[model samples]
Target: MNKYLMTIKNKQYIRFFLIPTILCLILAISVVFVLLNQRKGELVDLENRSQLQTSLLSEKIAGKLNSLELVLSMINQSARSMDLDNETDRERLISLVKSQLYLQDDLEGLCILSPDGSKIYSSFHIITENLLENQQRMITTHTRQDISFSLFSFIDNKAWHLVLSRSLFDQSGDLVAIVGLLIETHSFFDLLSVTEIPGLERAILFDTAGKTIATWNQKDALGKETIHLEENIHLIPSFSDSNILNTQDQTINAGIKTVRFENSLLTTVKLGNFPLSLGMETFIDKAMASYDNALVISMSVLFLFIIISLTVITLLGKQVIEQEQVQQVMMDELSEKVKSRTAELEKLSTLDSLTGLINRRKINSLLAEQIDNRSKEPTFCCIMIIDIDHFKLVNDNFGHQTGDEVLIHIVRVLQQSLGPLGTLSRWGGDELLVLLPSHSAQQALDIAKDLLVHIRDNPFSPDIMSTISIGIAQYREGELSSDLISRADTALYEAKGSGRNRVILG
Candidate 1:
């Protein structure tokens, strides 16, 4: 209720009459504002969800590629484990891969051929039927240092596989037989079942050359664009794509915008990296369905509340003065109390009683929030944990007052060195946590070292040259807030461990 109504202490019945109407207005405004805010929030949430899913699919594709590489690695390991190049070890080497993953039958052949392309060891067992066609292809495609891959099609059998061949070298780098690993593409597709997000409905993977390799389709998909077509997002027209291979993996999620044949409606495209640029594209209709009932209920409730208010206001015209006045006064008092309490809580939460620097809790909260929010343009950031070396000994020898003054002096120097762009916090009894937002770890260390030098350089009131040790660390993307602090802590311990008056970074 507004303040004007409260000053009118008379009109008891009138006060009662106006109260309901004022409450109804407050409620109506609040509902509208909340609904609008929620709708905005919903849009941001959807975008994040879609992008995150796309990134995940990309990671899945990269993972499959890695798996292929691992299979090749295993084959190479087989040749080395048995010394395949030595004629005496030929039988054992031939049986190596066959025993692994229980694939003696699935593995068509294993042979050790000489550099001149003549058979040295043959597990295929056909005496007269020479391997000229495949052998010549392999020899031409690979040298002693070269690796090759080929798709093998069996006309009389029902199996799908591609073979990767790697030449083995000795410790002195001598040419050995080409090791082969048969990869079942079906198994790679089967591994795609691990993720559980819906409308993650479908994904198509493209090789580095943009050739379609595989896809995972939802049960309801039309399955045409998803069918082994060329791996071009432009060619498909239903999905959008993204890349995620730098050092680590990432995912992207997009929705099927439109079946251009159906309509050219804009679609959501999720793209990611694992080894391929895979994406999930779906119609916006799924999102619409999720929002439908909540939106309708919200509007319906708003309308119903407005009608009820109107009916009550008609029945009791001006009988709402006292109620409105009382509520208005209470709200003002509550608001003031809340404002004062918030400040008190902030002080209690952040400030150290002795040093007046931020406390551990506030420093930790700031560090976590900053890491999460400041990934893209981490202009500069560093952490420093400072401990008064032999602080307990100082308290025992001199006094707790002198120890407290040392802590205060430490913070004072930090404030002078760091200025406003940095933060200082009391981490524990004799330690201060410092954060320099626009500085590197080295920069922070320089500042810390300078402080130590100043302490040693300047003699205090009673001619004491007090000292402090510091730990420092820089930040990296996706790294937890703990990473820097842990490094700093270790560094601080090192500063103490190796002898005091130095800055160390783990």
Candidate 2:
């Protein structure tokens, strides 16, 4: 009877343990298989999305280029009918170009170049030599039947401009002149901005040689200035080789491809019939975030099932709950510390350490904001650049400590005199920049005069005398922040040059 009881006990134990073990193994395998299929589907969806976006963007670019080409052809026809040497003909051409520029906001300027690349007529006065060289190269490389595209810029700034050139031929079929259209890259940037989709981190436009022409980041699109091509040339992917771009078959060149680069999955599509390609990139983690979360949940469920099957569910669950609670507490503490540190850092970054005033970078951002607002709604705004006259002499005669004290004292006097009229920033050593919004040139001038008087009265020390020169500039319609600041700085130099301790309006 005892032997029979032992056998029954052993059979019950196997029934309780072995059956559930087998079932759990089967369930885990099924879960993994389903997850694999799901992951594959997700990847395919991502690929399809990327391909569709790339094709749409390519078509948009091609459409814009076609429109530009039509305009260039119209201009070429007009050029062929006139004689560029005659003064009346030149005036007529200029008038036509100016009218076109006024009509098309995307057109930056227009120019007619001789066969040798000398400018015969230009709508704008400032032309870079690089434009001439590019035109000349186009004239030399392509036949009269071909229309060419190249990049150029103005002499004053580093902004990139795209040029579409078509050659003009006389009845003899010899190249007579080249008609070029200058295109604003900002329009292209705007297009990119409009077409941006979720999960897209960056979109870059590059030429056949892998030189970046333009780049747009989703995060920086609104606040930051457009990136200079020369500065971001190295950002082009290394896999963008001639083998990919120089394929003999045209269909292959039109096809889009996906490749991996660093931590990103890059989708690249060549622009239609142009020596340019657009690349859209997204980080791998961002692209797979949903899939990763689903996988983790599925794995955790399988783990819980296994634990329950082992008959230690209640104790293990309680332990897990305790561990999770502890983890949450630790995370909360860490988050609080990080928030405190970040706040401290942000404050330190924007303010000057010594005088507790706004720093140059913060002031520049504020000025830009004001300029943008002015563009939207016309307003009166002025900026003043104040320089402590003969400051270097103070450091030389007295000590650096006394010079610092003088700077601090002057800041206090200016703050007291201005009295909420303007924002004061420490531009650099012994130099301050004040932004006065809703103030006209005359109001700004009066404020500057008051500041000068206050500085003259306030001495750094009993023995040390300090004075400041003020230069003021009012914002003009459609003017940039840098240009406004430049005028103020110029006025400041003039005030110092004429005589110290004076106010000048720019």
Candidate 3:
């Protein structure tokens, strides 16, 4: 057959192609095996490090809580030592509560409730009638003989607050009054804030019931009363001396010992004497991000070389009839195409495709340039950190597509408002930064106010009207860009705290 004759004629070319293909396959397998082994070792080390970090976090929380407990005990002993029956002693006790209890940063307020459930005194305003009723109910429900902390309860349906109560008794052991210190739930978050670990993907605290209480990444999850545990509760670790649980298993099973979940390792430690568990999850993907990128680049080069080898072999096979100059031209065209593709990828790195604005990397470079030349300039330069208020709500309710549209709309409005005087860039999720050179702080504030008014008047969508909070920081002559941004960020939070849709100067 003519096919058999053609195969015989090209046998040498076929042998050359198959040899390199087999070699390439073997090399790929070896690379994969090595990468897997390296990843396994890294994961093991990460687990050990995470476990140690979790242990340290537990010790810290315990020490802080115990210190607070000691302070509470001392206050209770001092209160019990005073004779409340005497008017002079009562006046002294009031002074003690005002000077000592009210002054503590951990305490939001202090209240003294009479045995009959009437409010004797409060550090804040006089207790409202509703708050008095709730306090009375709480006192009756928690009639512990010793110091105790109540479950988080809302104050007049506003904010979640916990009450640390100590019941006082006279010489005859008759209950006189219950002293309660109001602790805002924010205090617990402040305590947990120190537990944040570097390279941690997520750090969350859950109650014994597996209900999420606080999270470092998901701040909105706090005070969500309806939140409950799911079947993934199997991930919750049983308190043991090991003080760590991690597994890299395909399924969640009881016998499994590793703390691996998906591409992340779960590390947990129980808080001492509290029905809370701290969970720290670190992702292997992120840990290996750099290595993976390099591997990809190497693989791409290897594939390119393989393609060139095949092209050269094919060209040589046709050398009996074709010219060598034609093969050289083809190679040059391929090289040019590869270079163009690389250039395109490099260009994309500096842009945000969604908003079509300069990305964080570009903005950072610009900021650095501005900071470097700030001393030479006479007029002030300012960084405005602008955040769209409740932007996450828009994504949650209207979906991400709508969210993208909203972002684009915002970028358009900002561009029109800022004009050529300022450079606008995407700072983060729902955050944008505007750098204004040769503008005074007062001038920047005026622009910020006008931008806010413009946003309030021009709605993003029919259902979702968006407002922004702006925090402006004027660049100090000798300060670093980071410090300037930090001040701006702090002021941004202040703006959000005071009320959204406002501008604050840092």
Candidate 4:
């Protein structure tokens, strides 16, 4: 009977241990399954986030490219009438290029190469020998594109380059010069230097041929040949499927799948109208291991440490959540500040500091855009060039501070006179440009007369009497903005030659 009792006690103990073991096994399986699903969900969320970020970065890059294109166009137009052989013209060209380079800090170098590859002018203080060799090779292999972008590396420096170039054309459409700007790779990286999500292992940008152009902190990979393609063969299927959906207006749903070699997730976005794409990768195994480790610790402390572990985890999680919330708020505030500063800078760039009127460079850009639109629609546009008569005399009599006050007062009066019918911009010292869209030459002339009468009647200062010389030129079909402005300037000279306060129409 005692032996039977011993056997029964042993069986009961075995049964007790077996039940708990089975329960533990079931719980482990459930946890593993839940963790796997959670990891999958995290990967999906990461892909979505990456896709949005890539799209935003691509749009930013595209905007920069557009700005570059506009710059090239301006340089081309400004240089078209300029005889570079003349010392004054060459100096003016150099000044223009230097000003542009100053405005765009990303431009490491700005140079105008002659057709024979001779360096005519350069913004950088580099040895011209290297520039000459590179440009000569470029010219030799050049296709007749008006504007082009190319990626290259320097033999002297590890810095990669994105060169934006435009062929300067003469009045007869003859290619005269090759104007180009070199942008450092770091400028491209700035677009990606933002908040990064966890699980994101890599963020890369590549050219159309799958060559790595830029990557986050991946300096060594730059200018490498088709590294992205070799590393991301599995992404080809996804890219192919989503290529049709990617557009400037649309945010594409770039679905995530496993990477080629590693246990990873990948997504990509193509920059609009550019032969470049942005890509992101996330490692699944590494991202999941931390959660698994925590789970194991929790399971190991089933009874004795459960209460302590739960309390610690709860407090830590709360703290982490609070910290994350604070970080998110701070990030949002920083982003807003950056955006505000950028907008302010952009606005300041386009406006004259003294008079609060549009600057000459901005006016040129506006006129160019208007001309392009008018060329398509065949609309009547008028450019009026106005100069302050005896302005230097005012500065000579009064202080420059007083002269500044006079300029500001004049701009305000012009703004009031023009109202919404025209745009008033400062052309240079004591000169202003009035753009009248969809207006005839006679209408512009009438407006100019009114302006002259108003200025002459209401003086900026009682002691210093001021009048304006007016030059009016109506836009002709297929004429460039520079050409129109030039004609108006000729008329301005005529007005000044005839009389200070007179109006001349060209």
Candidate 5:
């Protein structure tokens, strides 16, 4: 009878303890499998988003390059018209070059290199020797008929600038001079900031040789210093593979690619037809934070289920089923919330927070779209820039709250006046841009005059009356959006210079 009791006890232990333990192990493995799959999905989503970001960045870079090339082409035409040998004509050419720098804020300086590679005229009083040498090298090796890009350092390597050079030819088809446009590397930093990603660790623009041209590191705070790497050092070590860095391989250079590192992920893309590449790095741990939290919760739930199974096996089985159902519901809810929040963020990104008007970035996209459409089918379009005269005084004499009220008041007046005419956007502080598609210059001018009257008539406060200055420009055929805006901006400057509360046409 004692032996039979012992046998029964062993059988009970095997059924209750050993079987449940084995089941717990299997459950843990299943949970891990689900979490791993979830983590993989997250990575795929990240890559898709990163690719979109890189493509947007490339477009911006290409737009900037196009603008620069346009400026160079304009300068070349102007220079070709003037006689460089004559002192008076040469002075006029110099003035023209200086005016270009003033019109385009991105241009560091403009210089005309003689056939012998010596600087004939420069906007700067002193042209550095290294800059001249770099331009000379570009001109010597450049065989392309279009604009050529090269990187050069100046001021004892304290400053780096991207040089855009275009060769000028006389009517005889002989090389006359090379017009060079210098752009500071920091200008490219704005591109990175405008398209900043949440988990971005570093954003870099590199030449074909893997030399860093411009870089933005997450460690640097606002207005801190920008990092500049040495000429020989490669800022991004992961791109050391010859195949990856090969510019001639159109297959690799066609689109953005994801490169996984030990601790991070890299998204790299080549600037279209340019010898430069852009790379954005994001931290893997930060990106997987949600996955990590979910894993922890799952493991805790599994442990709790194991404890319950030891106590009450049947109850534990029911609890496991119920918990899984609850988890699935929670996950569904989480996904919905994420999708809703993402949509909201995208909408908010395109509008101004204060005035609820379309923001500068959104307006730019609209203008670009109009330009594209115009290329396919010709049409008239005009852009107007409006500035609040003495806007700073409102904030100085009154408080910021009152200033806010004034801006809102102005936006309301403009909206009422601009019903169904065009799209109005808040270009920047105390400034706004109006896009009038299918409107001629005179029509835009008339609209600007009407807007001036409306603002003058409606006062934000009895004590505070706001006035505006308007600049109008009609888009020309084959003109760039930046050039059109620049013309309008120049007209605005003229309007402000002559008198506030007036209209000027560019």
Candidate 6:
């Protein structure tokens, strides 16, 4: 039963990749669907708002026109009753205009102008008798636009007002005077104050020149293009008919725009007849914030799922391979038997019989891995070639066995000295190599000096104490492993030529 269970475990069929991946894919697709749906819904909302803005802009502007209509009514009424050439008729026209404005509060003052821009009447009794006679010196001279309603600045600069003008005529069709009323623009912008999708959206009114007449935010823009392509509400098309009802969303540019028009101007409004158009936009930050949050959550779940799946696969693979248990069992059985058999091989592959340090073959492989994996951290390292000082004399004087003993003891010392900072290897018979990982030339010099001091100070064996010569060179980019090793080796030759037992800086 146990064997059968192990066989079943080795089958490696327990994983759920087909399902989990499909499910992950499905979940990812669902997230994309959710994102797309949310975006679509928001866009639909934006489209609806744009439509309503177009309509409401007409209505809001129509409401704005309501004040102008009242002023036009004043102009039309004044011309109906009076024969303006007579003094009685002229005074009657002035009194009639003032009386009509008596109930209207937005009217700062009303005025009648001749074609030559002379004020025929003033609503304020404070008007001087000759104020009309002095054309240039009177109040402020405003350029006249015929038959249109506009918001204009008042003289005291205390407030803004909507001005309406129309061609006034007698019943017999004789031309008389121009009547205009100043309606406070503040009230017109106030009606448009509204909020949608929390504080993410805003509404605005643009004039015939694409200049914003009013906005929910206080924009000091009377002439600046609100419908400029890279500007304010962002490139509303020129009005084709009296109304513009559709638009496209554009990608963002780097520069951020400020909201210029203000008042309490925002509200969802119904459709009506008006010349001005309305536009509402969602703040990119607010709209994309929800999408970003969803993506982050989805990515987190995806990464967690991937990690768990990989871990499960690895564990399952280990169970199937059974390599560790097999190897451990083999090693345990051979532990005693192989010990005495390899006696002549005290060489133990590449171990210096004198020292237990690694051979050059292992160092070569280690260097290959280090250099290849160094993409993660591309930096310099130092290579040092170490050789014993006057080794022929040491061996000849002390006999080969004692000499061998000295080499072994020195290898042991080098291995212990490097610790984990470097890879210590027996380069050839008496030569050694030390690769100090991520170490600079100066650091390598210090290390070489330290090692030399330790060797000269420590007793080599019962009979002798000795020191080593080291030549250190820093590794550079594009240098082959062999070339780097050769450089250090050359430095070592230089050290030997210089004297014995000194570190030659390369």
Best by lDDT: 5
Q: What TM-score, computed on C-alpha atoms, does each candidate reach?
A: 0.37, 0.50, 0.48, 0.48, 0.53, 0.44
lDDT of 3 at 235: 54
Candidate 3 C-alpha lDDT tens digits along 442-476? 99999999899888888887788999999999988
Per-residue C-alpha lDDT of model 1 across residues 1-506, encoded as one tens digit per residue: 34355446444434544566677778878887888788767655655665666555455545554554566567666555556556667776655545643543234555555556776655554432234454555555456325343322211123334344556555556666655444444444554555434444455444333344444554556742333333434554433343312212333333433222221111233232232345445444455456756777887988797787777765554445545666778987999899899999878778887877778889999888777667755666788888877779768877988877866776676677667757888898988888778787677777877778766665345644578888888887667888778888998999899888888876
lDDT of 3 at 9: 51
Q: Rate the local accuracy (lDDT) of all candidates.
A: 0.59, 0.74, 0.70, 0.70, 0.76, 0.60
User: Which residue pairs show collisions in model 4?
Assistant: none
Of candidates 4 and 1, the better by lDDT: 4
> Where is model 2 more than 4 Å wrong at Cα?
1-13, 124-159, 218-252, 260-263, 312-506
Off by over 4 Å in 5: 125-133, 139-159, 218-252, 311-506
Q: Which of the two candidates, 1 or 2, achieves a greater TM-score against the reference?
A: 2
Tens digits of per-residue lDDT for model 6, 359-462: 88778877877776666788768889989887778888898988888888787787778788898988887788898888889989988988898788776765
Model 1: CA > 4 A from native: 1-323, 457-460
Candidate 4 has what TM-score?
Answer: 0.48
**Whose TM-score is greatest here?**
5
lDDT of 2 by residue, 1-506 (tens): 34544554455445555666677788888889999888878777876787778778878877787777777667767767777667897777778777777877788777777776677777766656776665566566444425343433332255666777667665456566777788766467667655655567777776655566656665644443433334433443433333122222212256787765555556778777666777776565667887788799989988787877666644554455556556666776799899999998998999999999999999999999998888788789999999999999999998898788888888988899988999999999888999999999999998899888888787877788888888899998877889999999999999999988999999
Off by over 4 Å in 3: 1-14, 44-49, 126-137, 144-160, 169-175, 187-202, 219-231, 239-260, 263-266, 281-292, 305-506
After TM-score superposition, the amount by which residue 394's alpha carbon in candidate 3 deviates from its true location, in angstroms, is 99
Least lDDT summed over 10 consecutive residues: which range in candidate 1?
258-267
TM-score between candidate 6 and the true structure: 0.44
